[model samples]
Target: MASSDEEKLSQQKEILNLQSQEVDEEYSKLSAILPWDKFSNWINCMCVITFDLELGQAMELIYPGHIKLTEREKSNICYLSFPDSNSGCMGDTQFSFRIRQCPGRVKPMCASHINYNHNCPVALQIDPGHYFGYVYFRQVRDHTLRRGYFQKSVVIISRLPFHNLFMHMVGVIAPEYFDNGEPSIEVACHDIDQWPTPEAGATLNLPLMGTVLQVRVPSHSDKPGLSQNLVVTTESAFSSPTIMPSVNDSDVFKCLFPILPHIQLIWELVLTGEPVVVMANSPTVCSETVLALVSMILPLRFCSDYRQFFTIHDSEFKEYTSRAQAPPPVILGVTNPFFAKTLQHWPHIVRIGDHVPATSNVKPHKLKKGGSLKTLDSKPGVYTRYKPFLNKDKAVLKRLVQGIQTNRPSEVQSAMLRRHFLEVTQSFMIPLERYVASLMPLLRNISPYKGTPRTRPFDPDEFLKSLDFSGPQLTTGIKGDWIGLYRRFFRCANFEGWYNTRIREVNRKLQLLHLEAMSDADLQSWVSGREEVEVVDLILKIKEKLTTASSNHLPVSKDVGEKLYKQMDAVIYTLPEDLRAVLGSN
Candidate 1:
């Protein structure tokens, strides 16, 4: 009996070891897509802010107190964590926003080598980086207090765009902090510190205090319906609330529902990187709506700056409000009414309100004129008169209205809306992607003797010339002024960013092709007609090229450099004895 028991224990231990090995191997494969070494932790800092009757909003306690913050940063953080009293924070509210990092502050370093144009999502495009603050606030009426109310918020600061995961963590941590105080925040922070680095397109099983939150970060290459699967699965005996689906899921549909008729127009505005402002009475709505607007042109990222939630106290208030210059291509979400007068000069303004009752007389399909810029009305509509190049898809409007009439689940309706937008965006991008590919020079034109070839500059007139023969009109079966739409897109930041990225990719390909061809060419033939000094000069030039190819500044493959090295070795052996000795000494 003892021998049998020992054998069973040994088998169990071996199984556990095999499982651990498998997990490690899987992680290694996923992490290869991006450099994970630069990222240190999942959550940078976790803190609790409370409303003190005398001091107003103040940081009550922050775990891992070693994080340095300037007084100005601390003040702004405290105020942002807590919502305005008029925002109607009855039981609980959740939101997120971006904050600019002060100069010389220590922050997570992102790998500059990753080609953001292809792999990374715009959410993780931190070239001009900032800190994302995820907050969970709660308020309740309390006669015992001087203000007759009690309010507090728990905040998480992260450099990553783990929106769904971090929001889930804060939801769990905040309630526990309110109940037990500092210990809860400390335990939650420790758990977050142990999490694996966030790799794009990777699903992670993050263990919080007692439950596991399963989440996936959207990859740049994800197909249309893949994002719907970004759901949570709980593993612990203790029950945890289900985390809302990721940003790509139906949550965006909820934000776009009120403006469903004008969605395509709004999408164009975002794709062109036009200035946009989303206004709502609640900060949560304003922030979510802004984020949703940005995602409309996804797969193709909106490269211009955007603020999920903007306050009058924000540092860029003056620059954004000034009339001294043209409005920068930016999107701002505001709950305060002050922006109405200040931003009146802006072109597009989307005003969102609480859900309109199904019985209300307002027509969901028609465009409505907005109220005077002075009032905070809840009516939802696009407050712009700018005409769209493409005609409205009346079929989409019919389906959405039918869903609302039949009381279909919002998630299903949202999925339908997302599918429509995805198809539209993909169709629009296909021609451009194809055109960019045509701009690359033929492989035969690449030569090491000459300077590296570049992709031809993008000309709107040249691209438009190809549209009549083949364009989105034929592919999508949707017709309108395709020429006009492309013309507007040419002026936007999105097009510029996309064009520049494609140019870089094409240039890199040209460099690699040159290297490969030079490696295979017979050096003897070229040197036979040249002076000895010229031959020496050529050898030194090849060495310099090899050095540059190996450096991080140039994105050349290692195997290519090795091939050139082997070719040089063979050439050196064939050189005259005197030349061979001179080359060997160097």
Candidate 2:
């Protein structure tokens, strides 16, 4: 299969060369295909962003499969593959996509090696035909051979489904402009992909926003769903009880996970010198359509974070096709054509009339993914880029198998590893320590780096031992100040892959023990209560710390802000057994 793909890629390359000659023969006709320049810019940006997200797959393991990045190379032809075979890829769910940007940007090595910047608008083109380079490109024409020069600004994307609108977990390869200095960059859609107008005759919203994932968190004695109360939001599209907690008892926010990658894919295509349709992840999983989901996942701060992360917002929906969210209903019964997100009053999935099949058409299987495999030039990366998230947990759990003396209690090996990263690891302790330390030198006379002034152990086993582990406590400052240097450190960096390493330990237990035996309701209660304290404290301290440093060190705001962002990316592991495990430690 691999060899066949490689050979086909070689053939396609030849075909493209042949086509280029044809293009030259009828340059005017071929060039007039679309707003190639503008579209190409969009595609380039998307590819860069998608690549960036893949690199950020750090502690994804502990969160089940929530931390995911699926990628395949751009081939002369497009082929699709399923990262997870769909049998509960959610809550352990996995999915994937193959993207072809402005074109040439298919290989990971090529993308990784691009000269990156934080200031220039990242132009990442996966366009093999007129592939956009990580570097910028501009058309330069004379009476002679026409030429394209790399310029700043613009990216492109493809492979975005239109049925749903929600938060996207996109990664970006920012042109030097948005680099802010990180390897990857990102953006998000306020909601799922809607047709330019759902009323458009004969178009089917191929992707359903909630199918990819939608958990119906039934309103119980303790929890409630949305009530008919009007709420408000801070910025962008819409505001609801989902992002912001309201006093209403029966309110629910059908929040969607940020669909960052979908946007990235679309932008990659736009950046490619071609005007193509924008597709998103399965519409079923988009935020607006997720009629049911854990309300806790939809935080306004995360929904509106593109400003801080992407440094810009240029998201727009386009036409595309895919499978429906769930089984469809009678054409007449499919009344209100699904609603989208806050970005607009109403958006519908757009399709080029011809793309739609008979209203009663049923697919062999749900839009069977990997359907696009016929489009590949070369079989690409393992999509294992996020493997670290899972592997780290596996490695740790395996290690714990040796240290733990417990006998197998219903698959103890697997149980202990579940939800490990989310609830157990001290993800940011050290990097955060260093980041906090860096702030220390700027805010006070104490040097952040040790030796010359305070050289250090980097993360000495002995040094960690010296510090007490019982608190998000405060330390005495130069005078009467109650500083949280250690606490701040704990939140800033994910040291020793501690978050991954530790979460693996706890998840094993989660998997091994019967969930019925332990009280998930009790656990949920604790999470709800503990979340109030930790979240409030985290947001407040973060805000306060930033403000304090802003006044004390204006010169370091950028650096400090980045440090804060990193802190947020660090996973918080406060599970039921985590503290107990700490206490049991000798």
Candidate 3:
């Protein structure tokens, strides 16, 4: 009876302890979610810029003017906000870009600075010293206005890639500000200020002027099978918020439909980070086409520089157009006709326009052999005749064409394109991922007494040799000259960035493993075999390793080093009192 009672008491205590821990964890999570900082605003700054007849471009109002900005940054912002005169008589236009932040400026913790790489296998590699700007420009004919034009732009600058969210907010705010003026802008800024910290893959309910918008920021590390469908709802019982599509969900079909036949070649060029130019009739077309081209290699972030809307006034205009050297590896989207003559030296030029049907007299075969074609009237197509390695997916083209004929929803068409690109990108990346994995050293090879084993250097020729046995063709079951494709890809900037990042990651893992092995070692046995001087040298070395690991911000190494320190301290205590005193004196 005594034993049974004792056992019951112990079991009850364990149950209570577990329940207490559960409560503590739940409270911690709640605490993290609540207590929003008053100073943290979703938007870092907002600017209302107008075209000045006398000054060229001027800032009419920079809200919360305390935000420090250099002259160069202000100049770039003002110029980028307004479209050039070439985009003649535009009603309203929206575009997004990234610009380098002012040097040495302290970046605040806001939606833009939130690290999106939490729990990601690979970090979202981007220039951390830049801010992304979403601009909404409006041009109207007004007799009362100076220069007979009312031209202005509302610009939102932030660190977040909330393209769709910012666009939606600006769409409402710009129109209201245009009609009612500064008060409306104040209200919009306040609404954005009240938003919760934009957590990756979390649905947020944002309150805006008697309505609530439900939105989700797409995460870079989103799992393959997870639901990425963005649900946007409003407070009204009869209405819903406009569904904002992400960059990934943007309509590639509309952008690429005119040049569908040459899409494979275009994809290859982009993958290799080739200098390509996209010329379109409108700014909207020009920017969207550039984004669409970049998106075709989904899941693989394009690390090279690209401008969605490149203008003659842009700082890089001269560097990009200089004829003294080969064009830098960049993709530029331009609307001005002047680019046609300036960028003629570029390797690939994609001219986009509305599809024009061929007249009965114009035969496709006859035009193919014409060496002397002299007009822009030549059918819209990719100017370069670059051969594509991978076989083009006929099914994707057929489906997109069928969708157009049947008048399918734009969302549906976008989804189809996203799916196709996701598959294509994954198929291309799988072999590379596998090959890199093979280069890592086995666990048994790691030792506490020796230096960390380095990952084997990547050899292009050796990798190509392994393709026949295990490559994209076998992994994806897709027919292609993948070996040839990779041969070219090796020469590109994207491959270089990917390889460097992967190498760093592998080295980090090796260091972590070495530290863990040292922590698990028998320090007493190690010291027993060494002389006094050798033991002191070992102590100094361990101290140096710990300092280096901590300074480098390597969490795993630091944690293991702590354990190793305790083991070393125990061994030191086991030494003679005279020796311990001598060690302590040093």
Candidate 4:
């Protein structure tokens, strides 16, 4: 009996050993299939991270995947993969996050598959829950281009449906600019269903606005499906409520992440010489989105192009379409007829028209040649290579110049001056001050760049060597101040050197329109008769007289002022229709 018992015990021991060996083999297979080293490399390259709101921890351990940027076939693409857990409770709920890449293709899981597969093609399963963001591609400078190479990095996070997996949250690890310089997202979800309530300090190391990220999660009483508000605070020594707020409250899954990227994309397109037309269907989201996109993105250049089209007429639609023809690659929606006419010409069409479409039809202005009304070119940036604000009436052009000098909107003028200064510095080798002085010839009734036969133009090489911007005081000035200082170096350099610019521009238009030769009596007759003459002869007569008096240092008489006022009043009443449109009724 004893021998039989011993044999049975030995058999039991053998069975235990076999079971242990099977368990070890299975673990080895898991390690091989789910290689930690490869996963770690991905995390390192993309800066992948996860934060636990309930635990107050920024955990970077391997977690379930949603979307990621990865290299494929020597090009970068977004890879969507799910995380499989081998450990503790992932949580009680799950959330799905979606991202849309512009110019970059999205390869999603197969339609039949429940989850994303590593081997399938990229395509998103677009449905109700998917919120979208944009990715823009901009070129970096080589040796010649200034400001070094241009690099864009953006991080976008959209709210998700709830799931309590081992992982809490995931986001793109992009360069700061892509996400407006915020890389990590600290999410504090309130009124969550089934999931554990987040503690006050659970989310740490969040990307701060000024210096430090401060998160406060209020205690929630035991309840399910009750809504909770997420309060986020980012504060620092330099942070203020205006620039950097102390508290931010939001819904459990609300998003305001569209503004940064949309503006960035629009600016990138415009500055790089791309065509963009924005039309929205609805007034709220569509119109606001377009406005927000163009508001601060190169305000001087882009603000005018962001037209609010409530409804479209045939001619207005035609004009809208004409402005979008060729050269710059990017094109937004025009009016109906315009969009329909130019549809075949657009290389890529982004249908945002559904957001903000034309609401009403507008009668198009009648076309005129060499008249007061200025026509926008099929390709903008051309004004006979000499003049700007093209096709403006001589009388109106003169008034615009006078307005720039006498009643200038200082802020707008300053911005315009800064833009011109930057344009010069980007291309010319001379100092900004010298460039303005050279342009003084335009004000002095001479050439824009060169002087007349008797006087020599400002030498570019000599001026380049003479620039003394080495002083710290001079170097510390902002763009507007620098332009102001440049203007101060020249006589009548108001409007940041643009005052004289309008003078030369209007004068050139007069010469081209053959109105410069009109006599004083003939011009007066035309002004009184409303003849749409080639030039504002009275204004030019006054300007030339003013220059002569200045050169001779002669004091002007009160009679001169009276004559000017009388002529202006006569012209104002008989002003061309286009000029009146610009000036508007008092």
Name the candidate that leads on lDDT: 1
Q: Compose the digit string of candidate 3's lDDT tens values, residues 1-586.
A: 9999999999999999999999999989766543334324366688899988888889888765556678878888887777766768368988766676767775543433435443222323324577667888898889997688789999888755555677777777888899999887777776766887665667778887666777665565676523354556667788855655652355676666666656666788888888888877676677778888887776676777788777787777889999999999999887777887788777778877642332223222111222222354444446764667888888887786777667777667767877777787777888898899899999999987777798888988888888878777764645778888898888988888888877877887788788888899887787886787777766766666676776655666456767987976876776778877876555
How far residue 517's Cα lies from its native spot in candidate 2, in Å, is 64
Models ranked on TM-score: 1, 3, 4, 2
**Model 1: per-residue lDDT, tens digit, 106-170?**
45454432433235564345443577789999888989988887798999987666566677778
If the candidates were sorted by their lDDT against the true structure, best first, what order would they fall in? 1, 3, 4, 2
What is the alpha-carbon RMSD of candidate 2 to the true structure? 28.2
TM-score (all chains, Cα) for each model: 0.84, 0.22, 0.82, 0.23
TM-score of 3: 0.82
* Runs of candidate 4 exceeding 4 Å displacement: 1-259, 262-265, 271-273, 279-281, 289-294, 297-306, 310-313, 318-434, 441-586
- Tell me the whole-model lDDT of each prediction, alpha carbons only: 0.74, 0.24, 0.72, 0.30
Q: What is the C-alpha RMSD of each candidate to the true structure, in Å?
A: 10.7, 28.2, 12.8, 31.8
- Using TM-score as the measure, name the better of candidate 1 and candidate 3: 1
Output the lDDT of residue 70, model 3.
80
Tens-digit lDDT track of model 2 for 12-118: 99999999988887877644432233222122223222111233211111111121223323321111111111211121111222223333444441221121111
Off by over 4 Å in 3: 1-42, 101-114, 118-126, 225-227, 246-248, 354-379, 533-562, 574-586
Worst 10 residues of 1 by lDDT: 32-41
